[model samples]
Structures are given as structure tokens and as C-alpha cells.
Target: MKPARFFTPENLQIVKRLVSRYPPGQERASLVPLLDLAQRQHGTWIPPSAMQEIGNTTNLSFEQVFAIVLAYPTSFQWRPCAPQLRICDSWMCCQKAKQRDNGIFEAAQSIASQYGVEVKTTSCLGACYGAPAFWFNDKIHTDATKETIKEIISKEFT
Candidate 1:
């Protein structure tokens, strides 16, 4: 991870306000918001130096800050694609994947590649019934078919 390039004075004030929200001895609670501030200020990505600064600002060690960053799905040390698409890749979705993904991918491939939209798989999205599910624009899409997935691609990139 690179050092964050934009932790300006204004961002520091925001971090102070965010940390102040937590009561004494619970400054760790402020890590998420402060990381969010770091991402926003540094250009939609968090950096190791931002983590270090966060640790220093909150009295946490570098390892402690790193653990939280790794544990949180929304926090990333690098940039994400313009539209990150995550499909369920669990055993539960195995059959559904066979039934649907080929066409969905065919329908989605051109647009996804052209727009730099990412279509990848995850272990689960938490619901077995929604096997073959995916996340688009932060919304879970379950039992998705080629048409539905295409709609998402079209709406987002076309």
C-alpha cells in the first residue's frame, strides 16, 4: 500500500471530529470513519500511511489498524473498479452457476470489459436461497438471470 497523498489540515479536523464521537477509551470505534476520511481525501483509496496516521491518531498499533482494514469488506488499500460485481461462488450456487453464468457472462462480457466493470465471484453473499447471487451498486441481486444481469450492465455502463 502506498502512503496517502492527501491528508490535509481539513481532513485532520474531520478525523478529530470523528474520533471525538467515541467516548474516552473507545477511540478504536472511530477507525472506520477515519479510514473513510482517509480514502475520500486520498482519492477513493486507503493507503498504508493513512493506516499509520490513523493508528497514531487513535493510539492503535499498525497491526491493530491493519487487522480492522482487512476484516472490513468496504475498506481497501487500493482502488476498486468503477463498478465491482461479485457473484456467489459457493457450493450452493454451483448448479445455478452452471445454469446461468455462461449466458450472463456472454451478455455481460462486452460491456463489462469495455467499461472496466469487474465481474468476479465471492464465497457467499449470505443467503443460500439466493444462490448465484451478486452485488451491484451495493445492492444484492439474487436468482439473477442473463437478462437481469444485462439490465444492470446496461443501466450502469451503457
Candidate 2:
């Protein structure tokens, strides 16, 4: 049976382009990228329907596609969450927080809670030199301050 299509026409074209990047027998290699694109298109989550479409396009079963998703929980979300703050939990970030005694993670969590923003701690945001870092609304803040976080969240939520 034909899988239910989830991607819009433009996204479907992008998906085809992504798949084409792999050789004929290696289309499955595009699964992760496809999932990322699907999540971005869906505004933060890959719904089951999108997964089904990805599986169909990649010649994988739904279970197979889901297994890949399960392996990378941080990369894929099953539900939509906006106004997100992703704190870096790398060793450097942790140490920087400790040194500053400002608790970037704790402070961000507190501020995000007040503003109804979702907060998560993910792997390195690739700003070790800056030490403390977090991503909010698609922008990464390095050497972050609690006041800055509060200000940004207030502006975004209120």
C-alpha cells in the first residue's frame, strides 16, 4: 500500500534531493537527515505520519524508522515544544557554570519555568571555548548570563 504522505510538495522535493545524495542502494542513509528535516518542518517534532513517510521513502519499515528515532531521543521529538532552551551539558559548560557560580543550567530552568518555556540539557553545542552555552529560539548564546536568559525569555514569552 502507498504510505500516507506527510511532507508538503516543497519538502517532498527536498526529501527526494536528500535521498538522491546517497547512491541507489544507499537511500536508507538519508533516514536521519530526513527525520531532521521532518522535525524542522513540523516545528519541532516528527509525528508518526512523518515517520511513516520517511520509512516509505527510505524503504524501511515503520518499526525500523522508529528504532532509529528511539536511539536519538534528543535529536527527535515526538511532540511539539516551542520557545525552547537547550542548555549545554558538556564538561566545559559544567565547569564554566561552576566557576561563575551563577548556575547557567539551574537559572535557565528557573526562568524557562516562569515563562512556560521548555528546557532541555543536550550534548555539546560546539562552543567549548565560550564554555557556558545554551540555545534559545534557534540562537545559541555563549557565555550566557542569568539576566540575559531572563530578559530573552521575557521578551519571547510575554
- lDDT: which candidate is best? 2
- At residue 42, candidate 1 shows an lDDT of 76
Model 2 lDDT on a 0 to 1 scale: 0.87
Per-residue CA lDDT of model 2 for 14-61, tens digit only, reads 999999999988989999889999998898768999988998899999
Q: Give lDDT: candidate 1, residue 4.
A: 51
**TM-score of every candidate relative to the true structure:** 0.61, 0.71
Estimate candidate 1's RMSD in Å. 5.2
lDDT of candidates 1 onward, in order? 0.76, 0.87
Give one digit per residue, the lDDT tens place, for model 1 in 30-144. Answer: 9888887887777766778888889988899989988887887564566575778777778877677686556554555665776788877777788678766777876888877
Each model's Cα RMSD:
5.2, 3.3
Q: Number of clashes in every candidate structure?
A: 0, 0
Model 1, CA-based lDDT: 0.76
